[model samples]
Target: MRSIWNGAISFGLVSIPVKLINATESHSVSFRQIHTEDGGRIRYRKVCELEDREVGQDEIGKAYEDADGSMIPITDEDLARLPVPTARTIEIVAFVPEERVDPLQMGSAYYLAASGAPAAKPYTLLREALGRSNRVAIAKFALRGRERLGMLRVVGDAIAMHGLLWPDEVRAPEVVAPDAGVTVRDQELDLADALMATLGEIDLDDLHDEYREALEEVVAAKAAGETPPQAPEAAPPGKVLDLMAALENSVRVARESRGGETSGPAEEAEVRTLPRRGASSRWTPKETGGKKSTSTTAKKTTAKKTTAKKTAAKEADGRKATEKKPVAKKPTAKKRAAKSAQPAERSAARSTAEKATGAGKSTGERSTGAGKSTARKTASRKRSA
Candidate 1:
């Protein structure tokens, strides 16, 4: 890349001539304004608000508003005439340890290269010394007519210059955290440590910009006059209810996913601690293959068995009800009537026999009129004789 500015970095008596070029480039895809239905580009014209008509390029002038709300027109000559320094040298103010610099205060970076063969020696000297000392030089310089605070540091074999933000430029963060009553349990902490152990160190190679990649793919498809494929639906992440449980599950998933991932010596030495309340979880690193192993799948299998047993119990209870219904049906109406009537008939017959035994007379003694008339009949026969 061509150098955007020519300058020299001076610290003490040492002056290193250098040129500045941008360190990074934008990877973003740019879009154009267009008429969607007509497939035509949309052109916008500059118009004057007061005149209600198109304005020429000469009519536009940059202006700043004053306290009285009056627009003060500014020109290119007016900006150059200001007292701000437009020096070609980056003057180093102070040298401090690299950690003293806040990453948030650092802005855009530019690559600093030697201006010519003569400047190469001093450039190499500065880079080597800074690398060895593990420190950065804070400097000030004028770029594009404005003064900028900067830092010079060793990046790889070359020197990198970064623009630092002014004190007033950075906003003070306003954050409110939960009260001291919020606490992290040791079990949760242990689980988090275990999860970290399972993860080991981050690999930059695995990092990707999925959204940009998909957008590029869609753009490519549209350029080829083909229908863009639908994007895959991402599953919504579940909220964590229990910190320890979430951490344990995360560790468990991480371990399972680390099929071919080998841990470095530093990570391999990490000893995982047990989870809360019990040692029933199969998460212990030592006895993982044994019965005491911590396996999420095993837990799920246990749950399935318990559910099956409950379902079987409910089915057995239903079967018992069906089985007892037939036993109840065996007592028919005729059998019930016979069992119930036998006692009643015997009682009635016993009552009749009791009445007959109370009187010692046969059927003849029961004829009351004939027994008294027998004497009268006998007297009548004697009178006739």
Candidate 2:
């Protein structure tokens, strides 16, 4: 246990410097308030009842009212200014028999040990002296701004301290007491004794909390992707017409359930199969390829290229043949511009061309063009004959 508080135990002139450590812990499961449907944490806000308005933490202050009924505010600074000599010291009040300290007065228990090497001697001395005297040392110390009344006693091989509750803090028994006239029969008492004696003995350490165990089992089933079997509905509790019958029935149940309380699963449940998850199982489609499909695609592409090349060659040959058949060229832009700029220059060029040609090609081709074609056709015919 780690020390939570560093303080000294002052008795007379001797101050045994020691450390305080809690000796007990609660293992009970804790749960927070939450919305049942959405599982959201439920929230609570502080509000002033008189003003009917939400209160901010900073606006709230501690106050006390006296007989005059006037509120007297006490600031945190004011509390800090008050002197508390026992703030870091547990002042020994008195030593009393251990029986005098009632269990009802105990609040929290903690182990107190020596703080350092120098304090070890004093710590041992206190522990040994308390153990030998068979008594507890009562002390008062301030912790977290509140003064606590505690008692020191020897526990096992070390010293332990228990913070006690004030007398008025614990409720009085007189407030709500059970029936005062209830009487017991000697035969009933004997039966009860026999029942208790007949019950099977169970070691406290061997006993298990059924509710906590069942809750854990449910959680385990959920984690394993399976549904936990539902428990059978309990029979309604019958009214106790006879007290003797009830006691006898309870004894019978205690005996029967002691050995047969827990049972094995009635039916096996199938677990859901999750997808495979690993480095080797993870990849993309781009990284996957088949050699056979790639080869077939390459072959088809090559065939298409060959067919296109053949078609292109035939089209180029036909275009060359049509070009060689001859066609007149259109007039150039410079000639048209020159004609527009100088009409005289255009007329002179036209007259010179007409004189040189003597005659122009009319409805059909010129006689020279026709004679040239006819001569070629005749030559071709003679060669064929």
Candidate 3:
């Protein structure tokens, strides 16, 4: 890289000569303003107000306008003569934690290269010190024609410097926050966290300026005398009446894009209705529940019902087949009558035995009498039949 500035870093009594090279570059497409009707370039010219005529670059000089409308011509020689020590040197003020530097004050970044053989030792020393201490060096350096605050830190093996705006140059961020009356719920915060997790981390190096690429394509197509590719129409912005729904949709879309399973919190996220500005109480989730979640629930319910119906139909068919089969029959009447007659004969024998016992007969005599009576009754009945 070409060096933009050459200076020495004043670290206490140690002076390290270094060269400043820009650390970043832009690849955006540039366009020139032209007359729409004639395809002619519309260029701006420097002119003197007093002479009312265009002037050349050499004739133009910068001037500071005072409140009283007086112009004070300030030349480069005048600025060069100013007793600013940082004009040719990067003076180190202090070493501080890198976090102490406000990112909002950061501006253009540049890499510091050791100027010569003698500078190499000190440059490596400062870089190693910064790396070991995990700190950055606060510095003041002159670039262009003005002095600027800078932060020097180690980037890999080399030291890089970032120009910082003076503390006074950064305005206080007043009145930029939401209204004090507005509040956020825990549920909303949870959904927001889930959305963030769903999107996950990304490698910044993998990203590029897509707009620049598209612009280049258009330029290439026009140069080739062919029709340029039509840009896809952007989805129209919708009023976020439901913050929870928006967060859930964001998480779902992120998961789909990553082709991953839904995150735990994202899967468990419930649809909550929050009162939106200018929205009516009638605007509820029930009314607008036809979105993805509601549809998913409906589909699940339908699937369950279909499964249940199939199971019930199978059970009904089983019951009908069971009903068609014959059941076992009861015993015949004659068999039942014979079983009743046997019990009666037992009762008669018991009576006969008891009568014989009452008469003081021996047990052998009772048994003989009961058997004889039962045989006589059976023979008499058989004769009557």
Candidate 4:
């Protein structure tokens, strides 16, 4: 890497000469403005508003814009005369634990290399000390025409510096959190933890800039006068009506991606369907190769057996009731026939009595008539004698 700045570290009374080399680089694809019709590149020229003409780089100078809309021209000599002590030195202020440095305050990073043979010893001493103490050195240095805060720490066998923003430069995250009224449930948290475990850890070195690579492919295709490859259509996003379901699906997908084996809590967590509701909402943590899990499984098996037995008993009872229904209907039909015969017997007895009474009355009347005739014949015979 090329050195961007040359400076010395001021550690108490000792000074170590070092060179600043960028420790990171950008791999983003850059584009230039162009005329769409003619495919002509467009370039910007610095123009002086007062002269109304384009100006060269040498003719342009730095200026500060004031709140009153006035320009304050600043020259190199004026900046050099300023009372900044960290112009050519990285002055160490204090040594603090690495955790004291907030990540939000960290900015660009650079490596500090020993400038010469004499600097090698001091640089190695500082690196070893930082490594042993597990602390970073807070520092102040001037770069790009301004003084800035930095943190120096040991990186491998060498020392590196990370430019830090001033305390005032970092904004307080007052409104970044969700609404106070929103709350998370324990079940939701459990699933989230499971998902995190399923995802597990990955080596940062395995990652690459995929967007840049795709852009490069498109550019190369266009240059070769061929059709650019099309990206696969992304699945449409669905609204999260159920947070628990979303978390479960995420865990499932993560497990699938890792060949169905997940580390940590995910391995212990099991998803099962609720028998009564017929929905997969229950999360049970099963300990592998443990007596407790075995006992639980045995208990479940026993419960299932009990349920099956109960169901069978109920079915048998139902069948017995169905069989008894026909037997009960037979006696009911016999009772109905006996009740219908009583009215017919009463009617036959009444008709027989009426016929007997009529015959007796006729016989009596004949007897009375015979008696009267006999008396009359006797009286006539007596008169004739």
Strongest candidate by lDDT: 3
Scanning candidate 2 in windows of ten residues, the lowest lDDT window is 262-271
lDDT tens digits by residue: candidate 1, 1-385: 8999886888678887888999988888788999999989998999988899999899898888999988889887876566644377789888899889888799999999999899989889889989998899999988775788999998999999899998788876655555567878776676667677778878899997788888999999999999997967999997665665566566666776987353322223233343678666666445552446557769989999999999999999798658646433422322333344446543443443344335443642343233224324433544565
By TM-score, the best candidate is 4
- Residue 157, candidate 3: alpha-carbon lDDT: 85
Which 10 consecutive residues of model 4 have the lowest summed lDDT? 348-357
For model 1, name the residue pairs that clash: 282-293, 282-294, 283-294
Off by over 4 Å in 1: 44-63, 69-87, 174-179, 260-385
User: 1 or 4, which is superior by TM-score?
Assistant: 4
Report every candidate's CA lDDT: 0.72, 0.70, 0.80, 0.79
Tens digits of lDDT, candidate 3, 132-191: 998899999998888999999988888999999999999887667666788789977988
- Kindly provide the TM-score of model 2 when superposed on the true structure, using C-alpha atoms: 0.53
What TM-score, computed on C-alpha atoms, does each candidate reach? 0.61, 0.53, 0.68, 0.68
Backbone atom clashes (below 3 Å) for every candidate:
3, 0, 0, 0
lDDT of 1 at 106: 97
- lDDT of candidate 2 over 1-385, digit per residue (tens): 7888888999788888988887877665666899999989998889898998999988999887978998889887866566886878999899999899878899888888888899888888888999999899999987766888999988898988899987778888887888689888774565465456546467899886788777777878988999986889999987666555565555555546665342222111112223346745455322222234676679999999999999999999688547735422212322343354346645654453344335443622463354344334443544565
lDDT of 4: 0.79
Rank the models by lDDT, top first: 3, 4, 1, 2
